[model samples]
Target: MSVRTATESDLEAWVALRLLLWPDTSPDTHRAEAAAVLAAPEATAFLEKAEDGSMRAFAEAALRHDHVNGCETSPVAFLEGIFVRAEDRGRGHGARLLAAVRDWARGRGCAELASDAHLSNVGSRAFHAALGFDETEHVVFFRMPL
Candidate 1:
C-alpha cells in the first residue's frame, strides 16, 4: 500500500472513508467538511491506497491553537479521525498514515500530538495505546438546555 496527501481528486474516496468512520454524519456534511479541510492551511488528510489504486483508508488531522487535553503545547497536532476498512485492518496502513501525520506535524513545528476517542470505544483505546500514546485523562461532558 502507498500513502500520500489527499487532494481534490481524492475528495470522494476521502468522504466515503470519513462516513465509515463517522457514520452518524450525512454525506453532504462530510463533503462540505472534507472540502473545508482540504482548503484549510492548518489541517490536512492522508490517503492509503492499495496496489490496484483503490483507497483503503484515510486519516485527518489539524493544528489546534487552542488547548488540547493532555498537551502542554499551544499548537498541538490533533488527530481528528482515522479509519481503515474492516478488511484492511492489521496490515499497518493505519500506522503508515499516522507516521505521515507525525511527519507533517513535526514539519509544522508542533511539539505534541493528541487524539481522543469515545469512552466506550475499547478498540480505539487499544489502538491509541499500541501506537505509543499515553493515557492522559478521561473526561465526561455534561450539558443543560438553557
Candidate 2:
C-alpha cells in the first residue's frame, strides 16, 4: 500500500495495468507507446505498489503546452490516464497516485490540471468530480476515410 514514481524497470507491470485500463488497445501499440513515454523526461508516471510488491494502480501525466480543451497558450498538466484494479479500489491508492501527479504538475509551473474521461464511465466521472473537476463541455468527434 505505497505510491511511488514509476521507473523504467517497472515498464512491464505498468504497461500490463494500462492494457487492463484500455482493453481495446493492441499489445504491440501499447508496448511502443509505453516505451516512448517511459523514455521521455517531460512525462511522469506513478504507480501504487501493493503489500505483496505488485503494482495495483497507476497514473500518468505529461506537460502539454498546446491549446487544450479550454485553455489558451499557457502550459497545462494533462493527465494521460489513471486506473485502479477492481480488487484494489477504495483503499486510498488512487488518491495517492493523483496527489503525486498534482505535486509534479505544480512543480512544473502549471496553473491547472486537466483531464477527461469517457462520458459513459460513471465511476471516472464521479472520481474526477470528487477531485474538484468541473464539466466544461461535451465534445463530439468524427472521422472520415481519406
Candidate 3:
C-alpha cells in the first residue's frame, strides 16, 4: 500500500471515503469543508491506498493555536479524524494513515499530536491506546445560544 498527502484534486474522492467511513455527514458539507481545509497551509489530509489502487484509509490533521492537552506548543497538531474501511481495519492501513499525519506534523515542527473520541466509542479508545496515547481528562460540554 502507498500513502500520500491529499490534494484539491482528490476532494471528491476524499469526501466520498469520509462519508462511507463515518456515515454521519452530508456529502455536500464534507466537500465544502474538505476544500477549505485542503486550501489551508497548516492543515493536511492523507490517504492510504491498496496496491490495487483502492483507498483503504484516510486521516486529516490541523494546527491549533489554542492550548491542547499533552501538547507543548501553541500550534498543536490535532488529528481531526481517521478511518480505515472496516474490511481493511486489521491490515495496518489505519496505522499507515496515522504515520503519515505524524510525519506531516513533525515536518511542520509541531510539538505533539492530539486526538479526541466520543466518550462511548470503545473502538476508538482502544485504537488510541494501541497507538500509545494516554487517557486524559474528560469533560461534559455545553453550548449556549446567543
Candidate number of the best TM-score = 1
Clashes in each model (backbone N, CA, C under 3 Å)? 0, 0, 0
For residue 31, model 1's alpha carbon misses the true position, in angstroms, by 0.3
Q: Which ranges of candidate 1 are over 4 A from the true structure? A: none
lDDT of 1 by residue, 2-113 (tens): 8899999998988888989899999999999999999999999999988888899999999999889889988999999999999999989889999999999999999899
lDDT over C-alpha atoms for residue 70 of model 1: 89
Model 3 steric clash pairs = none
Q: lDDT at 47 for candidate 2?
A: 92
Indicate the worst ten consecutive residues by lDDT in candidate 2: 65-74
Better of 1 and 2 by TM-score: 1
TM-score of 3: 0.92
| Tens-place lDDT digits, model 3, residues 47-80 | 8877787777889899999888766777888989
TM-score of each prediction: 0.98, 0.93, 0.92
Question: Local distance difference test, per candidate?
Answer: 0.93, 0.87, 0.85
Per-candidate alpha-carbon RMSD to the true structure: 0.7, 1.4, 1.5
